[model samples]
Target: MSKDNAPATLPPVKRRNAELVMLGVALAVTVSAFGASGLALDGSLPVGMFGYGIGFIAITIGTHVALRFIAPYADPLILPLAVFLTGLGLAMVWRLNQGDGDHAGAGMQLIWAAVGMLLCLGVLFFLKEPRVLQRYPYLFALAAIVLMMLPILPVIGIERFGARRWIGFGGFTLQPSEFAKIALVLFLSAYLVLKRDVLSLASRQIKVFGFRVFDVPRLRDMAPMVVAWMLAIMLLVVSTDLGTSLLMFGTFLAMIYVATQRSSWVIIGVSMFLGGATIAYFLFSHVQLRVMIWLNTFDPEIADNEGWQLVQGLYAMAEGGLLGTGLGAGRPDQNFAADSDLILVSFGEELGLAGLMVIVMAIFLLVERGLRVALASREMFVKLLATGLSFIFAFQVFVVLGGVTRLIPLTGMTTPLMSAGGSSIMASWIMIGLLLRLSDNARKPAPQAIQDEGATQVISR
Candidate 1:
C-alpha cells in the first residue's frame, strides 16, 4: 500500500515520552518556585541551588526512568502529577523555613522525598501483581489495627498538639495512622470482593415513602460493616486522628457501595457515622471544641487559642486574594502547622486563588484517573482496591481544604503530597505506586497464548 493509502489502524504507542516531557515541566516549576521564594525574600537566588537542584532533579528523573522501564504502559499523567505536587510542597516547605531557620528545612524534606521515591520504587518492583494482595486480607487487617494503635502506646507513643498520634525513637517520630490507611484500603478491597454477593443480598426490602429504597441485610452480612464501624470509631477515640478515621471509614463505605452496586449501603454508612459523631460530640471535650470552633471560629473567646490557627489560615487565604503575594513574599508561618495541615493555605497565600484552584484541580485529576483505572480493570479485587485508594486520597484533600475554608469541621489531615510530614509523604507515594501498578495492568495488553499446542499435546498423550 502507498504511504498515503495505508490503513489508519496502528499499534497503540506507550506514552513514556509524554511522561518525560511533563516531568521536566514539573521539575522546572518546582525549582522555579524555590528560586522565586529566595528572590521574594532576599532579592537573590539561593547560594546552594547547585546541590539542591541536583538532588531534586536526580531523584525525580531516577524514579521516572525506573517507572518507564518497569511499568511503561502505566497512566502517564499520574507520575508527573505526583512529581509536580511533591516539588511544589518541597518549595513551600523551603520557603517557610527561610526566615524561621532550617529546623524543618527543605533539605530534610528532599531527603524524605528521596526515601518516599525509593519506597515507592520498591513497591513497584516487588508487588509484581496486585492480586497477590487479595490472598492475605486478614493478615493486613491485623497489621493495620496494630499500626493504628501503636501511636497510643505509652513507651514509644508521643502526644503532641493534645493528640496521642505519634510514635517516636530518639528524635524520630512516625505516624502509624499513615501506614494504616494503606492496610485499610487493601483489606477493604479484598474483603469486599470476597463477600460482596452476601453483603448485596437483602434480608428484607423496606418501602420508603413510595418506593422500596432500603435493603435490610441479614445480621451475618451486617457484622462486617458493624465491625468496621466500631473500629473506625475506636481509632478516633484512641489516637485522636479523626481525619484518618474518617478517610479510612469513608473509603470502606465507598468500596462497599462499588462492590454491591447499591446506594443503600452508602445511606446506611452515612447514618451510622452521623449517629457516632453525634454521640462523640457530646461525650468528648475535644470533639465538642472542634465542633464549636467550626461553628463560630471568629468569636472573641474561641479565636485566642482553639480557633486561632483556623482563623489565621482564613485571613492568610483572604489576604492572598487572587494573584497572591508572589511566592515567598507572603507569610505562611502566621498560620500554625503551615507546612502540614494548613499547607493548602500556604499555597493559597503565596500562589493565589488561581494557583489554589490549579492545585485542587490537579488533585481532582489524579483521583479521576484512578477511578478510570478501576472502571477499566478486569479483576474485582483490582477494581475495589483502586477505588478505595482513589476515594481515600480524594477525601483527605477535601476534608483538609474544607476545614481550612470553614466548609466543614476541621479534620486535621495532611494535604497528601503537599504536606511536610515524612510519614504522610511516604504513604502517599506508596499509594501512588499501587495505583500506577493497577493502571499498568489495566492498560497493558494481555498476551494471546496458543491453544492448538495444548489440544495437540493432549491428543498425542
Candidate 2:
C-alpha cells in the first residue's frame, strides 16, 4: 500500500459481521415476541398478537431510525436488542393491564418510549463529539446535583412507598435521579481525563513493616469524588433511595478505576463505601427496615406485609417454570406493585424463565459489545464514556435483578428499557445514544494520521 490506495480499502468482513449480528437480533426478538404473545393468549394468537406485533415493529423502526441519525456506524446489534427488551416490557405491561384496567402506567410507558426516542435523536444531533461535553463538566455536575435534590424540595416532591424520590409536574412525575446518573457520568469522565496524570502521580508514602502505604489524596484531587460520595449517601439516607445511591457510587468507583488503572483504588473505594453504608444503615430508619425485610422475607410473620413483594415475585418466577405459564394466564397482575419495579417478575410469571433468560442474554450481549467498543476506541474520553455507560447498564441490571430475587435488599430501581417510567426510559436512550456515538467514532479512521498521509501524497503528486 500506497497512501492513496488506503482510503479505498473496504472493511468487508467487519461490515458483514455487523449485518449478520443485526439480522440475528431481529430474528430472535421477533421470535421472542411471538412466543410471549402465543403463551399469554393461551395459543389462541388473537388478542395479544396484534399488540406484540405493533409494539415490536414500532420500537424497532423507531430505534433504528433514531440510531441512524445519531450513531450510524455503531454496532447495529444494540438498537435491536434495546427494541427487543422494550417489546418484552410492553408485552408484560399489557398482560398486567389486562387485569387492572385502571392502571395507565403501560400506556404512559409507550408514550415515554416515543419521547425517549426523540431525546436520543436530539442527543445525536447536538452532541456530535464527546469532546464537546468537556466544556460543560461543572455545569453538568451542578445540574445533576440539583436534579438529584429536586425531589426533596418542598411541595413538589412526592414521597411514595417510604422514599421521597419523585418530582410531580402537572399530571406526570419524573425521577430526577435517573437523569442525574448520566450527568454525573459525564462529569466524572471529563474530570478524570483532565486529572488522570496528577492523580496517578505518586505522593507521599508511609512504610509499615516493609509495606508502603500512600498518604491520603490531596484535597483538590479528592474533591469531586468526595462530593459525589456525599450526594450518594444523602440520597440513600435522606431520600430513602438506596438503589440509585449504590448505582451512583458504583459508577463513580468504576470511573476512578478506569482513570487510574489501579486496583488499590478499588480496595479503597470498597472500604469507604462499606463504612458509609454501615453508618447509614444504623442511622436511617428506612435503611434498617429494608435490611430487616431482606433478612426476614421468608419468615412467616412478615411474609404477608414487608416480604409480600419478594415472596410474590419468587412465586411468579417459579410458576413461570422453564417456558412460563403462558403470558396472561399468570396471576401476577393480582399482586400489588407488579407493574413498575417488579416488572421482571411479571415477565417471568407470564413469559416463563426462558423468556426472562432471553432478555438477560440480550442485555449481556449489549454490554459485551459496548466493552468491545471501549477497547477499540483510541481516545481516552471515548474509552471512559463507553466504560461508564457499560457500568450503568450492568449496575442497573444487578440492582433490579437482586431486588426481585432477594439476593440483596430491595432498592426499588426500575429495570432499564423495560421499566414503565419516563425518566428511566429517557435516560436509558440517552446513554445508548452516547455509546453509539463512541462506537461510531471508534470505527472511523484517525484524523491526524489520515490527514498527514493525504498531505504527503499531495506533495509527491
Candidate with best TM-score: 1
C-alpha lDDT (0 to 100) for residue 152 of candidate 1:
81
**For candidate 2, which ten residues in a row score worst on lDDT?**
11-20
List RMSD in Å for every model shown: 4.7, 4.1
The sequence of per-residue lDDT tens digits that candidate 1 reaches over residues 112-192 is 889999988898899889999999999989999899889888899988886787899989989888899899889888898
Residue 296, candidate 2: Cα error in Å is 1.4
Question: How close to the true structure is residue 392 of candidate 1, measured as C-alpha lDDT?
Answer: 77
Q: What is the C-alpha lDDT of each candidate?
A: 0.87, 0.77
Residue 343's lDDT in candidate 1: 89
For each predicted model, how many residue pairs clash, with residues at least 3 apart or on different chains? Answer: 0, 3
* TM-score of every prediction relative to native: 0.94, 0.87
* lDDT tens readout by residue for model 2, 190-250: 8888889877654555568978754455556666666767888888888999899899999
